[model samples]
Target: MPEDLTRTARAEGQPLSETDNVEDMYLTFALGGEDYGVGIGGVTEIVGMQRIMGVPDVPAWIKGVINLRGKVIPLVDVRLRFGMAERAYDDRTVIIVLEVAAAPVGLIVDGVSEVLDIPPAQIDRPGQFGRSRSPVMGLARVGDRVTILLDAEVLVADGDLALPAELEA
Candidate 1:
């Protein structure tokens, strides 16, 4: 959690701890032309795009891994994971690091927007429209902007993609 994010959350009267109302807080980011969000709880930190060392025998979406601090974290290209066309990484590109299933994984995104306090009343669950499973947890509407809320666990643990054996706990 960044200082600014904490300040913003506090200013908005949103709780930031496990025993509080953390469920309503989401870290939003830009993906392609739309906005997407993930629960802030699992997010460890956000970092600028770093060099991704290539690895063998992994899905294309698994862009590779990056060494952060003393730990190597596997990077997942969110666009490719969602079956979207690849785009060149730019200055705005970032990696949202998360802890899923007790393992560290990084999600490469277009750019991050902001931390929003979206209450349950503002979110609409994604019912069984067709797909058997979806990464989307719900659709959150903040004023006129709608953000697709994604399940971080599902995003990283999708059927077609699996982290390298060493990356798993």
Candidate 2:
């Protein structure tokens, strides 16, 4: 998330698009050298480092759930989700609470960078924005990092989205 993103809708995100929207904000985080982003719309909160209980029989990417107040939200390691090497948690670790298709999930990130507002002009087609694994609609340059503006619905809940088998309905 950049310093400019709003907790609710922005004036720009209101407009419709033929495919991807022009007005959107992305919350940026780090996973090793690659910096990734999620839609600011889906973000509920950016919390400080917390304890995440480990559960057996879950995918490596699924770091398990946490007690967020009274709500139990599943935690996903963004690095592992991207098929990257796993690392120990530290002070910089953050849980980005997000809503995807109405389901709340917490993404474990290296750190919460900032909230950014990216106008449609900065965005490119999905192919140009991302690679084969994730389809992104836009890009935002934050400092030395280039964060991919994610389409939350697709990014968070893929058909073969590496979800824990038990989560299947």
Candidate 3:
């Protein structure tokens, strides 16, 4: 458990100290065959795929809710969130639990890669897309691979939260 926590912390890019040049660490994952990453600090845990109860009146991307240790956490499919076609959840599917705005939410990703330490020198600002909002934090180059880093806070905006009112209570 401690190791898992350590990995999670590293993935979230928790600053080591005041003098550490490593800007942040990211928890990389896959979605629609493309690599993406999120700050490790945002991730609470990574759990195997489970039953997700559907909710009405919410965006299609917002899959539904899951009973995680008696807490009802809303689930959002990363692929659908990015307008990618829905694919069957296989053995690799995992739900990444995150605390966004103090609320626990689940993000379904194709699979988790590994935690990477990305410094500022390796990150580049995202290019502007006309009339569209982006959830990207920055583009990180790790070795020969590029990972699209995401901002959890921006990804789950207050307006995007459509969990049933009862669950919010």
Q: What's the TM-score of each model vs. the native?
A: 0.84, 0.71, 0.83
Candidate 3 lDDT tens digits, 1-169: 1234223232354534445333376778998878898887778899999988888888888888889888898888888888899999999999999999888988899998876667777899887545265788788876677789988877766236755577766
> Residue 81: error of model 2 in Å?
0.6
Q: Which has the higher TM-score value, candidate number 1 or candidate number 3?
A: 1
* Residue 166 Cα positional deviation in candidate 2, in Å, after optimal superposition: 12
Q: Score candidate 3 by lDDT.
A: 0.78
TM-score of candidate 2 on Cα atoms, chains taken together: 0.71
| Alpha carbon deviation, residue 161, candidate 1 (Å) | 6.8
> Candidate 3: lDDT of 44?
88
Q: Show the lowest summed lDDT stretch of 10 residues, model 3.
A: 1-10
Ranking by TM-score: 1, 3, 2
34-151 per-residue lDDT for model 1 (tens digits)? 9999999989999999889887877899898888997888899999999999999999999999998887889999998888777788899998557777789999877677899999
TM-score of the candidate numbered 1? Answer: 0.84
Q: List per-prediction Cα lDDT, in the order shown.
A: 0.83, 0.66, 0.78
Candidate 1 off by > 4 Å: 3-20, 159-169
Which pairs clash in model 2?
1-27, 1-28, 1-114, 1-115, 2-114, 2-115, 2-116
**What's the residue-level lDDT of 84 in candidate 2?**
81
Ranking by lDDT: 1, 3, 2
lDDT of 2 by residue, 136-160 (tens): 6566554455667666665555432
